[model samples]
Every structure is written in C-alpha cells, then in structure tokens.
Target: MKGRWLVVPTVAAYATRTLRVPLAGWSLTGEAQGVGPVTRRVYWIDIASPRRPETEVVTHLLQHLPEMIPPVLAAFRRVRRGGGPTGVGDRFTVLMLGVRRGRVQVVEVDPTHFRLQTLRQHSESGWIEFRSEPLVGNSYRLTVVSQVRASSWYDRATYLLGVGILQRMTWESGLRRALKVSGGRKAGHGTTTVEWP
Candidate 1:
C-alpha cells in the first residue's frame, strides 16, 4: 500500500507547575527549562501558557535524543482517534486551545504521502480530526512547533518578540523533555542515549 503523510500542527496552551529534570525525576518550581543532547547537537523547546503560568522563567537541564519520539507518536494517535478511519479524503477535527480559544482546524491526511491539509473552523470542542494510513511502522520524522503569545495592551510592544523567542525555546525544551521521557521508557534508565534522526 502507498503511504500518505499528514502534517498536523497541534498547538496547545500549557502551564507546567514544575520543571521535570531529565533522567533525574527532579522537579523545579517556576519557569524552568530542560536541556538535552540530540546526538552531538544540543537543543531545547519551551512551553508557555496561561494554564501553567509558573513556568515563566528559563532554567537548564540535560537529556538525550532517543527520548523525544513518543509524544509525537501520541499526537498521531490523538488525531487518528478523533478523525476516524485512516483513508484518503477522510476528514477530522483538531482542537487547539491556547491564546486563541474555540479554535479548530479541519484536517485531511493523504495516505499516499502523509501531507496534511488544514482549515480554520470551530469544531466540537476544538477537536482536530483527519484520516490517513498509519505511519507508525514507516520511517519518518515528526516535527513539533509550539509557541506562546501574551498581551497586556501597554506591553503589546513585545507581543511578536514573545512568540518568536518562545517558539524556538519551547521547541528545544519540549524536545529534551520528550527525549528523557521516551528514552526512559525504551531503556531502563535515561543515561543510555542513542541516535535519533
């Protein structure tokens, strides 16, 4: 069977009460960031939301690459479940709760290549649904892009700045955290790092 690829961007408003330290299980309060190794290249991802407001500042931690793939897989699971059967022309609803509430995008994932189609529409509780063949066994990469936006009228000057800064930071921090969690499950410990990509 031919494989189709769907690129669904799942953006959420999040608030983390504690910073999860990779492999250490150590938790920190406030805005703390996790750092880790993606092969020889070090990177990070950050998440900011009104729900988890305490994570406003940035700190550092360490992690590995093998640790970051599961959440991406999980994301696929959510989209698949919400949509229905994985097939061509299948439609689904995607729920995105963040700076913009009640925001949903209709998605169609082509089974042949997995390229996703999205449209802005309010859905049933902001659920994103789509149909596409399973990419679980297929060899491909999952890219996650998350950003935070805030405004207070007077502080609106830096609104765009916050998005750009947070997007890169959030992606890096999230990647590290994903690595630690995913890798820990694959391995008995977080110390054992492997090649990813």
Candidate 2:
C-alpha cells in the first residue's frame, strides 16, 4: 500500500446528517438515503501508502478481502451441486448485528481498479470498489468506495443506526492494521460524505 486518503460525507433530502469520526489515522463518513422502497448509502475511505503499484495493492486487497473486512461479514466460495467451487459467485453471510446472506454478482480485476458486488433479497445489495491513483513523489493513493442498498424501512433504519457504524469502525481498524502490517503508513485523515436520493 502507498498515498493520501480522504473521505467525504453527503446527506439525503429528507434529513441532512453529517458525522466525522477520526479512527487511527483515517476519517470515516457514513451516508444514508432513502427514496421509496430503495435506500442507498455509501461509505468511503482513502489512504496513501509507500509508493506501491496499483496492481499489487489491488491484488493484495482482493486476495485478502476476508481478512480486511469486518469479522461479522463471513465470506465463502459458492459450491456447485456437483461439488465444485465457483470462484466469482461467492457468498457472504453477514452476522454482525443480524444475519443476512448475499451472493457476489460481479468481480473486476484490473491494474488500477478492482470491484466486487454482493446482492441479497432481504438484507442489502452491496458494492465495494478500490481505485489507485498516482500522486506526487513515489507514492500512490488508494480509495475504497462502498455502496449499499436496503429494500425495507426496517433494514434501512437498522443499517443507518447500528450496522452502518459498526461497519465503518470495523473497516477503519481492519484497513489500518492491514496497511501497517503491509509496510504502509497513514498520511492523514480521510473524509466521508453522505447523500440521499
């Protein structure tokens, strides 16, 4: 890992809310929006590491996704009826505040970018993406973008109040630890923006 990190927060029209929490050497923003049955939210975090290439960073993150994410979110490869394993269609069982199952729908492995999406009927539809940008000097910037959608009001409220916060904290701590172990130092505080629409 190597670069500067920033997180921005945006709010929804119904209720505009902003919260900035400093974690280790990073800033976290949790944003939530609900329009009718579909509620959308995003959690963003960025960091600067010690001049590592984008390809290496993306590969490391994707390969160690389970270790990087919160412990409550359990990820496993999907097995076919024939007893074979499907790599892309993995399953994630979230059990932090509650239990929800989601299946990975997409995976993009590029040098500068990597993305994964999980879809669930009763819980949430989730997307996680990582982008690496070159900065001045020999460093690079790594940005993590997380988007989540909840279908029901109950799920939306739960996510906004409890699950969302826990999720942010988990990622903040997990990422910092991972980066430090990987020989990356935190440059500054990141920003988080919330938006609803």
Candidate 3:
C-alpha cells in the first residue's frame, strides 16, 4: 500500500527494539525561539491528543498543511460575502486525511496562524491540536503533540529521536530562492536577505 510504504520495518518487527530518548518533542510546547540569526520573533507551535492513533492524525496533517493555510483564509474573508470553499479544502488536506472517524473541523484562523481540532461526532472530549508559525522568508515551524494518544510505539520513538530533527533541518534547503524577496509587511527583522542583483 502507498501508505504502508512509510511504515518501513513495520510495527511487528520493531517490538524487540529498545528506544533511545528523542530530542525532538523534548522541546515541549514546540516553542521555537530565535528562528534566524538576522531576526528573532520567538516562533513556536504544538500538537497534542489523548491517544496514539492521534499521532497518525497529525502525520496526515503534516502531509497536507503546505497547501491548506492560504485558501482557508481567503474563504474565511469571503465567507461573509457568501463564497463557496474550494481548492483550499483539498489543498490543506490535513483535516480530510487525518480525520477518519470523528467530527474533524478547523476551529480558527487569523492571517499568520491557524488551528485545527477534532472531537467525537457524538461525544465531546477526544481531540487533537496542530499549529504552525510562518517564519521569515518561506520558513515555518510545526509541532504536534498527542494529549493521551500517540502514534505507534515505533513511530513515537523514531519521530521523536530523528524524524523531527530531519524535518527541522530542511529549513535551509530553499532558504535562498524562497527569500529572494521578503514576505509580510513587518520585514527587516524576521526576513531573510539575499545579496544578488
């Protein structure tokens, strides 16, 4: 299966493996401080749920967030004018993907940030949180935390120890091109600067 491809060694084979403490979630609260040396705006994010299956919920979100945030904001503005939701819903497929059995919904959004939570279609408390901060340039930091739930035991261990680090390290791969020109009105401090003409 396309999804199972990411499972790799599979949960069954990792049963006997011992896990070392991963430094990722240890940051707790997903508070990212001093994003770039040029500008430090105190960026941070968090994701949490009550059970492990919730971690899968977050994983599904991560797969789609890169595209979802924008249109939702546009739709929100047009909501008062009565416009229908479009590409954005499909764009930010986190809700569509992560939410399997419950009443998945997006709670709020205000320009630079957005929030999503889930609840039982009939019950009231089972939920999860996913938040992100748009950084200088095209950079953003994301964090996911499960209240009581978490991903598979192996997933929890691997993600905490290394995957999170890998995710964070990608910050520089597109830094130069994406930041050719700064974004947002409050530039200078948090934005990245390119020297080419």
Candidate 4:
C-alpha cells in the first residue's frame, strides 16, 4: 500500500513531462497497451428533442462529472498540473472511496468526443470515451464506451470482488445525467453491454 501511494507522484511527473500533445495527434485509446482480459462496457441512450443538442450534452458530461457520479464510488478532480478549458493533456486524479485511486490524462476532446487515458500507476489501464451523436429518427444518443483492463493482478482481484458493480452504476447514472441535461426523455430502456473484444 505504501509503495503504491509513493509511486503516484513519480508516475504523475512522467505524465506531465510526456502528455503534452494536441488532441488531433494523440490517439491513445490505450486498448493495445492494456493488461488482462480486455472488456468494453458501453452505456448509451437515445433522446428525443434534446434541448442541449449533441455537443452540449458531451460538454455538460465532462464539466459536471461529480454530479453525475456518486463520490463513494468515484470522483474526478483536476490536478494542479492541469488547468484552463478541458482539453488534451488535462490531468485528473480519480478518487475512489476517498483514496487516490488512479490518474488519467485527457488524451482527446472535441465538441462531440472526449477520451481519457489511464496513467502508469492507475489500477486499471485503458481509455474511456464519451461521445454524443445523432441517431435515426432525428434523435441524439449519448454513449460512454470504456475499453479497459486491469493493470495489475491486485486490481483484477478487487474488480471481481464488486468494483464492477460500482463501475456499472457510474456509467448508468452518467447516461441518465446526459438525458436530463439534454432535457429529453429516454426513447427506450437503455443498454449496458459488457463484452470481451
């Protein structure tokens, strides 16, 4: 435990030094770099008459992450190393159950797409992307697609112990938050697909 916490700053420093790149050029979906069995957890919903539109819904999700997520599960706070508008190279420490759980850098963010890549010391390794796009029937859909795998054996053990439940809850609530922010009703029951790819 002490060893894990001590390595955080070292890995964080490395990220600060190397993570500076434009959103267009850094395409680290992190799947190829991940460890263990890779899984893609997708949560999405279709909305009708969206008040915030596609881009606005994506923006709101990134801007107000804590509101959409319960802190006891996970919370995102921008580190002092990152500032200004949420864009590429922005760093955030993921807090879980009030501990320094992991760190991630904003690897990509456009009007409709936002992606985060886990740092070296993080428990899991991968990318989580938030995207909003137009669906058929003139409706819009907001999706959170996480392509990830355990970075270490310890993390894998914990995940099977029930962290997966918290993960599911986080994205499920986030999809609902997107729906509310869009001021639209859910077109149907949403889907949460957990699949190995």
TM-score of every candidate: 0.25, 0.63, 0.29, 0.77
Better of 1 and 4 by lDDT: 4
Task: Show model 3 residue runs off by greater than 4 Å.
Answer: 1-8, 11-105, 118-149, 170-197
- Which digits, one per residue and each the tens of the lDDT, describe model 1 over residues 1-197? 12222112112112222211124321121101211211211232222211212111111111111132233322112223453334434332222223221221223233222222322221111111111111233211223321111222222232233533443444444444543433222111111113232
Rank ordering of all candidates by lDDT, starting from the highest: 4, 2, 3, 1
lDDT of each: 0.24, 0.50, 0.30, 0.74
Give the 10-residue window scoring lowest on summed lDDT in candidate 4.
17-26
Candidate of highest TM-score = 4
Which segments of model 4 are wrong by more than 4 Å? 1-34, 81-83, 192-197
Backbone N/Cα/C clashes per model: 37, 21, 15, 0
Clashes of 2: 21
> Which residue pairs clash in candidate 4?
none
Q: Candidate 2 vs candidate 3: which has greater TM-score? A: 2
RMSD of each: 20.3, 13.3, 16.2, 6.8
Error of 2 at 49 (Å): 5.9
